[model samples]
Target: MALIQTSLIWVAYAVAVVLLLIIATVFVFIYQTPRDRAVSVTTVCIFTMSALLATVLLMPVDIALVSSTSNSAEGRKKDWATPNEIDSIIKTLKIVYYTLYSLDALLCLLVVPFTYFYYEEYDEEATEVGDQTLGTRLWGAFKYTIAFIILVVAIFLIGFFVPYAKQAKNDGRLDLDYFQRLLLQNRGERALSFALGLLMTLGTIIYVLYTGAGLALLPVALIKSAPTVSAPTLAANTASQLEENRERQRQLDGRNEGRENGLESRDRRELEALIREERTLIRRERLAAESSGEDRHWLIKAWIKVEAVFRPLKLIGGLLLLLLALFVFVSMFITAVDKAKNSICGAHCGYILGYLNIFQPINYIFVKSSKVFPIDYILFLLLVLFLFSASVVGIATVGIRFLWITVFKIRKGHTSPQALLMATVMLTLITLAINYSVAMLVAPQYATFGHQTFCDRAPRHPGEQPDCTHNHKAIRPCTEMSKNAVAKDVCTPSVLSTFINGVTIDFPFFGLIMFWAQFAFLGVYLVVFVATLFKTPKMDEDQLDADLEEDEEEGLLASTGKRFGATWQDITGHARTPNYGAAETNGERA
Candidate 1:
């Protein structure tokens, strides 16, 4: 029965993987809007979905492996995958997991960086089309590949192996094999643990802030979605925008240097994009100003008037959402800190197999309150709702500053292929880091499935799993088996635990580096959030005006890419041409 089940799971997994890839490709190539936004967001969403699909598909088999041998647990033994059929199932899933993981990693690492540089427009007449040979294009990809490889190597050397290698000999790690030595080293893990804690702390901060924004806006967004309830909008100063567009065109022409003047390249692509966005904003504002609601029927006109009188409800609802977002975020963070401060875990523990833990206090409260008010249900509901909302906001949030730093984020509403690829690279790192952070945030619920705690499991025989659980209680920590040595009463790893451990897969160092880089983003999000508080956002300039479709995050690293464009233009003194060519009075840009 289990063998057939496993085969069915594999079949389903295959079908799902193909379907997901096709869907992602369709979204990217056919249906994407605001092209750069699609590139950045879809990359993360598709990869995350694929990871989740694998974990979910394997879960039933994992549960079956730990099923009780007898119907009743009075004298029954845990299956623990002891049967040959179960073992075969485990093997099948392992192969399936790694196969998908390898493909995902290949796409993220080798293919993404190569495309980032290789895929660019070339002018047919820039150099008589002679310089635009296959060799030149391949050279571009090769340089990017080599540079990316060098960066990865340097990160490992500096962040993990180099410092640890120096101390390895001093700690008599010479006695261990290379793999054992690296894995067994305590000093580096201490560094990594602290790094992980700091990262969770900062990620929580950004997460809560955006969630708050989403929740706050959600009320207004609901209101705006109505047929006649939209608040009046102010038109932009487009006369100035026209002047700005003219200046941009003049500057774009300056960068049309040499024979590339009218030929395709970065300059022309950018100028057209930038101008296109300016024109769009100008056109939108002009249309808004011209189209008054005077033509509406008497009933609709009356409805709008009545809705305006109730505008304060949106404000009240917005505040409640802000509070809810903060409450959820704080609960999740506290859970992590509580795990870090556990009697077994304490200051210097990574918890066996590097499990990120849960919100103990909140759980206890929910359990106690569950009997009275179904608080547990409410908690779960809030978590799902707010996290879903946060994910929506997060995709559009200007949190990935690598894109803002390395590539200038001109507010073009479209990206050149190179910019799109760069966004993908930045988003790949984000998907990994944010996934881990989110796993940690929700670990308590997911990791404790069908068990009390992740650490309260069967004891390891000496060097099996780390006693980062501290060998507390001396006796095995489970409920099913109280007698026989043969009794396999231990908890099987949870779906979350399996994914967390397997997510990083072969490269442990990559996890550490990705984490710390995310930590640095703490400051970026903090400044951005703080600025939002200090200055009223255009999105919220009027009454009840938030929308999910818009990227409302702002400040120096605004999601709209306003500040980035301003800063670049100021620094370069309005460069000759744009980032890509499209022949827009190209000679004057620079």
Candidate 2:
């Protein structure tokens, strides 16, 4: 029986890993595929798919932790024909967990970093690899991978190892044995990991909140936003835009071409901008010309129609996703606060999903869901996927948001190889953060869908389709339990609670961080949402209004004073100076 269950678990894992590979391959192919196809697509797929999968190896281990925390595994032990079977299953779980853990260390710390550089070396846009021989490129990527390893080690030292060393009072050893579950052995590492994960998780939260707001509001705004395009001027518009772009490019070339570092820094950036614009207009012109009456091919017309539908569908879907994400955030926030306040569960307390279990009050509706068997599990998985997909979307978009956004000044798009490397590293960190985010989202849906919880079979297996209250706790509190089928010490948590204690196995401080930091993340999210909601959406119109307001606010001499602010002369003399520039050149003509 143990072997059968173990084999089934591995089979499920295999299916999941394959699905992840497909998803990872599609993402990498879209984002990181070499522009210059010197490397085969097949090879890139194989390498990148392997790297992403290898880096993300802790899923099953964490799931096991969740199972243990809920005491579901203890409940499952009753089914074993022999007492040894429980031990056998546990031993198997530990073996698989450590195997993946060690392999993850090997691949994530060593192999994955090189994969990015090796792939990036073939990118024509990455000028750092310009004109280098294959051997030179290979050597550079190797050096880069080493540097990345050193950086990871340094972070490990600061975040985990140093603290662990101090706590253990053993200078030579570090707590690399991460096979812990709610045990307080390596508190330092857990706290630090929790902190780092908290920071990135907040970043992920902001990403989702803002994206959701934008997505929710975009579709209607877009449908109403009609551009004033002249039918006859399509070709003329492209020509003029291209000509203007080239003119700027020509000016930049002439100014910088003679310098030692030709077209470096901002000049290089401006040139690239010009080139991109030129290409965009050229493509637009071709498409516009082709679309003239019968000149448009049937394929082109079909694509155009498809795009019309596809664009709206995408936007609508984003809006729906945003709603779901907001609900998840609220649920998490509630769960955090409840855990911080209550500390431990009593009565029927273990698996609190907070707002995530909206279906609890209406349990009668889904009371029969347990009877659905595999269907119930499937539905539960779908809910998990939806919540998790939101987190993935947030991680994916966070880097892009940071890349493009600014506070006081406009940010130039990241076009340099250095920026590329930085983004990749950020991607790496956020990928780690996804585990925490997804874990936070996943625990709740089990209650919603009426899937089995620890209390489901507690105290002599109360009917299969148990209510949230019964499923949340056994017949009595752990302290009061006597002659019960469930373990005496394992307190079953209430399904009504948003977050269960001991849920976050590795990052034990996660609940506390979430509770304290709720203000910061939620505050930022609210600020962004409110500002976006009330503020003008049209940039050009806002700019025009501001310009007109500025012109109106100007006085004869005060306009100059406002422009440059109070000058040294004005400050020193205590004299309200007239427009200094205007006064200096007052009746002069060029």
Candidate 3:
């Protein structure tokens, strides 16, 4: 227990370090790329806020948890923190976590589906940029952002509050129902808020659709827009074309002279056919190369590769989550049945309620001591089988798919070796999380009981006196009976209590361990994923977006202002400033 506690403390420290590193990295990027001021600011704010929230909210929980676990295990009465303090910290953590969870879901709902529509509109040019009003776009963006925020808050209530309310109702320690009542009242308020928010979001969308505008305007207002392409300089292009024609004419003239001199006689029809074929092939290649396409940075390519591999795993995940939910439901059923049987039986075969008699045999075979065929054991075996089967199927399928994706994406120049290296690390971490969760569920049941011993009064004891210091009050012989006996308590208390208490403590810790472990793993994973996917340094080499390069060059002047004490206000003005060069060039093309 001490070792485990110590290990957990270290793990917490590791988590803190990792989170701090992420915060530092975000700030560093913001500092380095003042040109991407809007984007960098948004990124910094989100991450900084998240980190602050985590630190303030989770630190206390960690402290309380460590103290509680250590004191409880050592049987100490001293209080580093009271139970109330611990409970409060945990409650706060849950509230904040769930709130953030709702926001995450809200973002997904708003961004992903709408993004598809936005792209479709952009591709078709359904709404001409020149025709759209700036005020309309800004108003639409603001309305939707507000609506999403409100709707997310409402979602937080519906998803988290109702369930927590139900749970609190069962908590015997809560001396008053006042808090629970408050929660119910708040739920109603949140529901109302949610409705209003939904209406606002929908209303804005409808108005936009009616006005023949696109949701593309909303994201464009929020996130930085892609650099617009400018027209080619005609003078330079014409000059280059003329030069190329002159060179071609010279080559033709040389070929004619050679033929006239009879030094190089050839089939004229075949030569013309070959020249036509060559020109057609060159034209096709040039067209393919000139097609408008987004840049594929290393990280984006890596993601594309990873997505191809894990696309099928979405179905696998759904199946696994469904199976896990079923398992939990069955476990709950077993628990309820056990509780009911125990209550009616009263730790002995006392007169059970008549209605409950139907399940008496089930109680006996499963919950009770005696079993004819170990039906309960068979249930345990089935659980094991299912767990093993599900894990094996998931891991094997994902691994095989990853290998295929790696090979395929590498061939397509979409995945780098470094990306695969990071991917392998991710897989290992995922495996650890999955296996650890499963083991936590199953390991306690088969834990070793304390050393065997016979009480002094028992026969065939070989004269070896049992150490019943912890079990003396509970130990009794089988023959010692009365009209009713509490058969459940007829065990060595030392061993039984140790086993029972350990398992009990492990149950909640399972969730706690899984939470923080995944938290740390994901922090690392996101850093690697994002660094590989986006970021300017890694992307510049691709040269996929010529306009993007120009934007960066223009941004250099804005970034320089940062060194001379320019504020966000200054950066904002700079972003709004039009690039007359680009606009004039585009006008020429028009």
Among all candidates shown, the one with the greatest lDDT: 1
Q: Model 1: residues >4 Å from true position, as ranges?
A: 4-80, 83-93, 96-104, 124-131, 152-282, 285-330, 351-392, 395-413, 448-489, 494-590
Candidate 2 C-alpha lDDT tens digits along 161-210: 33332222221121222111223435443434434444444445543443
Model 2 misplaced regions, further than 4 Å: 1-12, 32-78, 81-83, 87-112, 115-133, 154-181, 184-319, 345-428, 441-485, 488-519, 529-590
Error of 2 at 330 (Å): 3.2
TM-score of each: 0.50, 0.52, 0.29
1-590 per-residue lDDT for model 3 (tens digits): 43454355445545654654464343233222222223323343334333322322232223223233222222221233345543453454446434543343343344322322322223224246454454554455455456555755666565334323333334443222211222333444344333323332332222212111111111111122221221112122323433444455456556678454532434344345445434533443332222111243333333333433343344344345444434433332343343345322221211111122122222222222111112333443334333323322222222223333522111122223222222222222232233222222222112111111123333225633233445465343221111112211121112211212222122222233332332343333234334422532212133333433433444421121111112221222222222235343211221
Better of 2 and 3 by lDDT: 2
CA error at residue 136 for candidate 2, angstroms: 3.7
Q: Write the per-residue lDDT of candidate 1 for residues 49-71, one digit (tens) a residue.
A: 44433433343333333332221
**Residue 338 lDDT in candidate 2:** 46
Question: Which numbered prediction scores highest in TM-score against the true structure?
Answer: 2
Model 1 scores worst on lDDT over the 10 consecutive residues at: 554-563
Instruction: Estimate every model's Cα lDDT from 0 to 1.
Output: 0.40, 0.40, 0.31
lDDT of 3 at 392: 26
